[model samples]
Target: MDSYTSAAVDGHLLTPVTRKPPLRSSADRHGPISKLGDDLLVAILIRLPNARSAFLCKSVCKRWSSLISTSAAVSFITVNRAGSTTAANNLL
Candidate 1:
């Protein structure tokens, strides 16, 4: 019994198992993912539930900071709605 116990203690049978890395964070770039280009980033932001998250992405970095500030996105939205210009101007 002592020899059996010693053998088991020195063998792989007593070794602890290591866990695999978590997968969800690796696969999903859902929000504020790193290394994204500006155009693709805007596409992701548009899919968010609302404009607040879109605007918050600006603080992520300098490139993102500038991309959201441009008139292109605003133009895209305004074109979709004719009255957007007047409403946006009022907000400004």
Candidate 2:
């Protein structure tokens, strides 16, 4: 049979532990969002509620800014380059 006892000091009880848990690395703490590709990032940013929200996402990092700017340009060109002149005029 094995037995152990806890020591009490100042009305608090303390127990002995065999080992402490390992500390997490900075990358592990931040998770995998940084690992997403530019295409996926652009798709996510496009789903933001409005232009202001999308612009806010741009300030998150330099990479995000580049992706957001590129996606916005592509979207603008696509909208303005349509065959229908009425659709282009209505945008203005």
- Which residue pairs does candidate 1 place in steric collision? none
Per-residue accuracy of model 1 over 42-90 as CA lDDT, tens digit each: 5555555456666787787666777777888645433423333443443
Tens-digit per-residue lDDT, 55-88, candidate 2: 6777887767777678554574344332434533
- Scanning candidate 2 in windows of ten residues, the lowest lDDT window is 76-85
Total clashes for model 1: 0
| lDDT of model number 1 | 0.56
Q: Which 10 residues in a row give candidate 1 its minimum summed lDDT?
A: 76-85
